[model samples]
Target chain A: MYYRALGFQKDYAWASHDDIPFSPPKIPLSQATVALVTTAVVDASIPKPVREANSYPIVDVPDHFDTSELSWDKETTHTKDRESYFPINDLRARELRQEFKALAPRFHFVPTEYSQRHTIETDAPLITRHCLEDAVDLAILIPL
Target chain B: MTARTLEAAGIATVVIGSALDILRTAGTPRVIFNDLPLGNPVGKPFDRDMQHRTVSAAFELLFSAEAPGAVKTLPHQWSTQDAWRENFMAVRAEDAATLEALGRATQATRLENKAKGLFRR
Candidate 1:
């Protein structure tokens, strides 16, 4: 579907070996602070300068941000519908239900136009630092 | 890279995306690959129940996945091929002319905003 969205068909090589490593949750989710992150280009609800930085900028999840730029049909997810990609509201609902100990103070939004190199080199570091600074115990990264 | 780095830093993370193959290659520790459309991974966009389920299911793996690079698929189907095409084909052929024009205009604005770091972040 992603390739079709880009109007093309291509082969993607999958890793035969599960090379990615994992770390168990340092603390139980019931006692951890959780955060949400996405590469959906959701509206930042901030100034243009801050939003358009040449380098990746970890911005706050704006209240009622627009999800139009996302690859999905905007008609369904307009400004009001965010669960399509940014599920902060769902996460919050879970929190209200005591699904987790607490919600991170902020959520993160990254542009979809970033190059893989940029994402690995620039965005990854900033995102890592931001998560660490926020003391995020668990994170949900929804890629578009 | 972000997920791997964060997990390496001792922060548990889960990736919920459609491109499971790409994500697996990228080495996402915990992944819940929903075979849904790109933008509507949580479900059919506005359906609160589906979105909530998707989120809940993804979070469930944070504890269930035992090994590094664990990947799982949710048993939810977006549609029975009747309405699924609407997602697969973003714009219908009949409405191409009209929608394409509007899309071009919107794209211009988005590009300008992106260059200026405005609009969607």
Candidate 2:
């Protein structure tokens, strides 16, 4: 749909795989360390231009990050409310409720790219390395 | 794709998204699909209760999903009717020219970024 809308000659080929990865939680939700990864670039405006993957300390996460440059359903909705997409506060409240043990020290920001190879081979490994370094037991991905 | 990679690397993962068709084929381990606008997947902006509920549901799927490729569709809707779906990313005839130019510029930027090795670890 997006490809056609963007005037591409053929529909974009979304990556598909037969050997889907599966890993059961190693720790109970009450004790697991959680991390967040989103498609929202951090502190980037249209002029600043973020075309790479990055991570920031969760405590340093902005109340709002720029999304005006990203592609989404801008007609019906807006990203003014950070909690609507980022949900750092909501996850913090959950941590207090003992829903999870703790939030990882850092949250990740991955750019939206057309190349699945870059995502699987480059970006994913970078995020996975960060998760391991933070000792994150579970990760929740929220893409805008 | 990151979820799949993370899970393969021994960390459990769950996705909260609004694009069902894309998520379905992406081979994600666990997903909570919200039938809302693209930008507001967790819930409507400023609606704290809805946002909390959506996150809670994603956690539920995380704990309960026994196999890979598990997906649960939340009952939330963007509106009373399905009008939003019809207009979602719908290209307008007048906007075609602008979109084409924007697309070309975006491709050029991507190529420049790639050459710079911006995403390489």
Candidate 3:
């Protein structure tokens, strides 16, 4: 769909796998440390038209994300409400209720890279290291 | 793609997305497929009830998914009419030339950024 919409000469070859990686929760949900990963970049300092993969502190999650530059269904919906994408406040309330152990100290941001190799080799490993360092047991991936 | 990689690296993941075809082909481990627009996957803006429901559903899938590649579609509707699907990302004839130029410029900037190794630190 994007290939035709973007007027690419050929179809974008999407990555596929028969053996998908699976890892069951080692601890119960109430005892798991969960983190948030989003395709939306949090830093407004990073100029438009240049998408980069990075991470931000969960403590400073913005009230709204500037998404005018990214591609999405803009006509139907907007990212005016940050919780609609980030949901840090809701997760914090859930944490108070003991729905999970705690929210991770930081959330991760990954760019929607066209190259699957770069995603798998570069971005994925960096995020994996961050998750491990933070001792996160689960991650909720929200792509915008 | 990062979701699967995270799962492989021993951290469980649940993807909340609206693109079923892309999510399925990508082979995400556990998916909470929301049949809404691309950007607002969790729920509509300022709809706290719907947002909470979506997050609760994600947690349910995270706890209940037994195998890899498991997907559960959330029962949420964008609107009563299905017109949005047709116009979801459709480029209007009037905006075609402008959008094409923007796409080219964005790609050029992306390539230049990559060449200069300008990843956020």
Candidate 4:
């Protein structure tokens, strides 16, 4: 309900942390490898939890993973119905591919649920090693 | 996950988010981005230029040491706005119903009734 009231479900959703596709003029790119760390549910061991029955963010589920799921319309809010909520606004990342690949084409993107698991095994440091394994010089950590 | 730990790994990390102050207040203990929302940390899903701009903007934080715990909010990207399940709400409900029906066939609910009668004493 709050998400709808705040317009996040529809439009603001797409405005999440993602890799865009535009090529910048020139930013004097860094030689360091760039990595993306997110809170996306990725443990094959545990099945993804079911969405809360009444928790907000349900209204934004996309209709489909493909194009029928989105609308460029600006008048009314474009609510997603669940085509791929796991993306967490990753559609922006897909669209902005050129932008990210430009900075570091070999960038490594990894998702970890450390915030939820912060008290558990503490996977953050291990995740860091995975990024560094690829010689990650800079890492973009996006938390949910 | 990646932000604070990578920094702990001695790799400079720049964090971005619409809930920067919220995160810091909650004791995130590292850099903060006082910009984008929970879902849209970098920028909206489609605006490449803004997304690129947002991503690069965070990288700029590395050059600043004026504050060990720093935060920055970038230019707001507002597009003539408007628009928004749980992933398993309906499915779980269905699964529960299926199991309940099967139990009734096996008399699980009936078993509860018999137990209640036995304990009525």
In model 3, residue pairs whose N, Cα or C atoms come closer than 3 Å (at least 3 residues apart or on different chains), thus clashing, are none
Candidate 3 CAPRI category: medium
Best model number under lDDT: 2
Per-residue CA lDDT of model 3 for B1-121, tens digit only, reads 9998899899999999988888889989999888998888899878899899999999888889999999999889988988889887677877677667766776787789877876443
Model 2: TM-score for chain B? 0.82
Candidate 1 on B28-67: residue-level lDDT in tens? 8989888876666667658888778788887789989999
Which residue runs does candidate 3 get wrong by more than 4 Å?
A47-51, B91-121
Model 3: lDDT of residue A69? 62
Task: Provide the lDDT at A11 for model 4.
Answer: 23
* CA error at residue B42 for candidate 2, angstroms: 0.3
Best by DockQ: 2
lDDT of 1 by residue, A64-138 (tens): 555554565443334355667778777777788887988877666655543455556666667777788889999
What's each prediction's TM-score? 0.72, 0.90, 0.90, 0.48
| Error at B39, model 1, angstroms | 0.9
Stretches of candidate 1 off by over 4 Å are: A1-18, A42-60, A73-80, B82-121
Candidate 2 lDDT over B41-113, as tens digits, reads 8999998988989999988888899999999988887779787787777778887887778778867886787
Candidate 2, overall lDDT?
0.86
Task: Give one digit per residue, the lDDT tens place, for model 4 in B8-38.
Answer: 5656666666555445543332453524333
**Candidate 1 chain A weakest lDDT stretch, 10 residues:** A49-58
Model 1 docking grade: acceptable
Model 4, position A30: C-alpha lDDT score = 35
